[model samples]
Target: MNAETASPILAPPLITFDRVSRHFGGAQGVTALDDVSLSIRRGEMVAIVGASGSGKSTLMNILGCLDRPSGGRLLIDGQDVSALDTDALAALRNRRFGFVFQRYNLLHGLSAAENVEMPAIYAGRPAEERRRAAHRLLGRLGLQDRAGHRPSELSGGQQQRVSIARALVNDADIILADEPTGALDEAAGAEVLALLDALHAEGRTIIIVTHDPTVAAHAGRRIRIRDGRVVADEGDDRRGSPATAEAAPCRPGRSGPVRLLGDVASAGRMAFRSLAINPLRTLLTLLGVVIGVASVIAMLAIGDGGREATLRRIAEMGTNLITVRAGAPGIRSLADLTSLTIGDIEALSEIRGLAAISPERNLRTTLRVGNRDYTTMAQGVWPDLLVARSRQLAAGSFFTRDDIRSYAAVMVLGQSVADILFPGQDPIGRQVLAGRVPFEVIGVLAPRGVSGGGTDQDDVVLIPLSSGFMRLLGRSHVSSVTLKVADAGDMERVADEIDRILFDRHHIRNYQIRSSTAAQIIMSDSQRSFALLLGAVAAISLVVGGIGVMNIMLVGVTERTREIGIRMATGARRRDVLIQFNVEAIAVCGLGGVIGVGLGLGSAVWLRRLGFDVLITPMPAVMAFSCAFLTGLVFGWLPARKAAGMDPVRALAAG
Candidate 1:
């Protein structure tokens, strides 16, 4: 029926539902609302009455803009609402309608004034203006004395009254009440009905959906629905005459542009307060993240230190030196040569770019001084071996060219060997037995610490190569050849040349040549593999941490469902609801990441003090931060979406 057939038109209808039907699930699903048609004019008080399962609540949902009609044209202030998407619909709901529910739907942790101010906050109202509007509305609703009370502290009727003030705070043109008196006792319900009557008297457009005939009697017009269709429309005498009145002019409220900013600030404050209240949970959450970060940092630091030390030791051994030992291909093993003769040394010296060449040979033998005998490594080399091999003599003198020519029985002992043979006495002039052969102790080499392979260099005796070969262990072949290249840059080329020369001399083909670069490559590959393995392990821990964040956020959403319903019922758009919860999740994760970084750095320092080389590089820190932030954003999506996509009616019904 048209407006003229029912009653004389005063102002344009604020809302109209034309042949609307909504269904759930697939094509065979049940219909929630079917072929419902109605119109509501500005400054009109209408009641939708029905028993349970009469489609009354579904109609209310459409009117409040909570759901879109599956079929039909629905209009609000001449705008076809059925054509809007989810975001546009939410925007229209926020800007054009106000809702009051039966259970009050107040945010449990917020004060009465804050609850009222929520709509203005979502409308982007400035803080001071929102405060002033909230205060004015609360005062108008007679809640000024109860502004600081939380929902739990207020009576049912008072809570509903606070919700009404929140609805009106946005100064919306239409007020939709869905079972507003349902949870109240007779006395409280009567007070709420009277309040609605008063607002209608002030020329506000009000729609109330209720099952009680007494509540419906207060409306200017009554529409009764059954089985998803409106069956009756009747005018009530108590609502005054419709024809004699002029339309009330719409007045725009003050700008609320900063409302969203205020809401963000408030949500942040609440998050901080919650964290402070549950200190133990917060600390425990941070602990998991902290340990993961600390392990990563310490491992890196130690690896870095070890790499540096190795490089330093390589430099000290002299980059110009090239050593050749007899070993299987790809494996380093000592050669079993009887001697490296003067002829072999001369042959190596003839190679181009060779600075020096020395024949090195060693034997495991016992040295006897008086009654004491000690087992030691007896090495034989050229007079220039000290300079060629980077050895330093600490006492007396190293063997000279004359000593080599004379085949002298004089020996230069390493620091460890000297200590054992001489004890506290000077052995420079004393003679010692080398495998029962008399040999004079002439010099002692300085102590050299252990190598990377854990071998001590200061446990040997040095004698002239000629004397070691002719007098002690008489054989022709040398153990190995040690060469000093003229130029360090030519080491690779010279090593190749040497390999060729030795292979030609021995009549062997395909001999492998080892170099420092090969050793470096092996070490680098090992480190990279180890680092990747450790990083994968760390990533797993991060995933667990992310899951923890998601679980907690889901719980938060469940606990705050009523709060979400209240905000949506006011003027909050779905995005506002989504953002508030998302921000809270991100704040929690970000805070945990920062604490983790601090702990990681501290752990690295502690490891360094314990003599483990660790390198906590900036890359890990950046990666850790990114992981934490992204964990919050990615995992928080499901819970935040659940909160945002909630049906306001169902949410309020939850309590």
Candidate 2:
């Protein structure tokens, strides 16, 4: 038999519509369906024919459970469906009825086999079972070779065939077709009609709705609807006889951890697959999140690194150490240390907590060794200065007190100076010239990376204070005095007492006094404040990225409304769509977060290479990743909720 004729094998009515009515909005809104009552026995081919705007499509929607009636009792076999929830309806659709739409409504990004397996997945079939079923069905349809092809890769007829395969993959007993051939030419339409006819002959009850006369004529019975009402019923009145059959069993309820994980996996696959379809749009959308997360990590790393470096340098000077630089009162250029004689140093040595005091004087001079001259700071300090400033001799001991008592020309070279002037050779007893006087190299100080005040410490030459003041420059002035305190608790009090003593001796308050503890506290507070400010600024970009995600997802929902409808009609619940969108949002931002981590690390390395002390700590990295993920969830919820709340029929109708 062809599609137009049906066997007289009536067993029971598989679907019944009893005075069903559907209204849109309210009494003022349009009436889409009104008082429609009808039934079709099993194994019968029925066609619903009407012009545009007639109630035929509404009737089709109600039968397939894609929509609900405003008022009426609708039954599938013996079960009433009007009181069912959305999830229940979705389950009913998955196992009972398969739909063929006018536009095919196949998801564009999915392959033929994948699209055909959609209903099985919602029905909770195992992956292997779903795969086997897809294979069997594709083979049965004589389209095994085209199973991997996407909708865009197929012709109109092939795509419609794929849709038909998808509808039947769940082995649904009744097939509902809404203008299945409307979009096809004569040849493709004929091919689809032949398949429908073959299914009808196999004892499957079929309902086809169309406005085309030739398509309607192919049915054994024809019901014509007009203006949301049934106007005429022609052919086989006895086919409406009352009969009852058990409704298809619903799948297990959607709950539990396993089901949740499955739901998430499915949603993730769909989300990522859809993203893969339009690569450019996906990449462009990911840009904001990437840049924002990257900025957060990079900025925080730099600020923290700089702060730590600065603090370390300050700490190197000694927390309880204080320095007094000589100067005259009311002098603006106090940076120019005028003079602090040995008398002033001796006067300050009596202060409490004065553990070890080192009076220091420096002169900028050229040191000549073996016909090579190097411009360097020539510092003259007492032996106690080494112990006060945390210095140690690498080769020989520092000069004795006798060297200071007598005007000896013995000199101690800094580690860097030793390396430069006497490379690969012992400099002990080697002679270097300073200010036209030959000095013996007695010792070399150990290397210090970066000095307390942010200068290179290993680039000086040390001599006795007597030698520097007497023989070298004929001067008896100390440029600065560095004092080490006995106890950290009394550092502040000690500093005050020393300042008073220095003021009394030097008779000037204009001199500068630097307390290591005070400088440390100030630098630490400033660095913390600066770090927080940078973090706050970087967080702004994360917010912007989140907003962009929200905006783009909302637009995505609007654009893919029809696809949402198709999924709902096939068996996807509201939460399924919601999860799909949320997963997409998270995936995009999470990937960006990862990339931002790499980008941030790269930036840190580059800054370090540029001579900036940048630190990449774990906390900032953690914060950046957290911000990115949070942005997605916070910004993506509204759009996902909107999509989930949409009516399936209305979504289907959206352009």
* Candidate 1 overall lDDT versus native: 0.75
Model 1, position 123, has a per-residue lDDT of 66
lDDT of 2 by residue, 415-532 (tens): 8889899989999999999969999998988887756556779999999988988877566777788889989898888888977877776576756787887767888899889888
Local accuracy by lDDT, each model? 0.75, 0.83
Q: Locate the minimum summed-lDDT window of 10 residues in model 2.
A: 237-246
Q: Considering every candidate listed, which one attains the maximal lDDT? A: 2
Candidate 1, 476-583: lDDT as tens digits = 556666787778688888888877776666665323444655665566567666666666677677778878777876876787677676677665677877777777
Residue 559 in candidate 2 has what lDDT?
Answer: 92
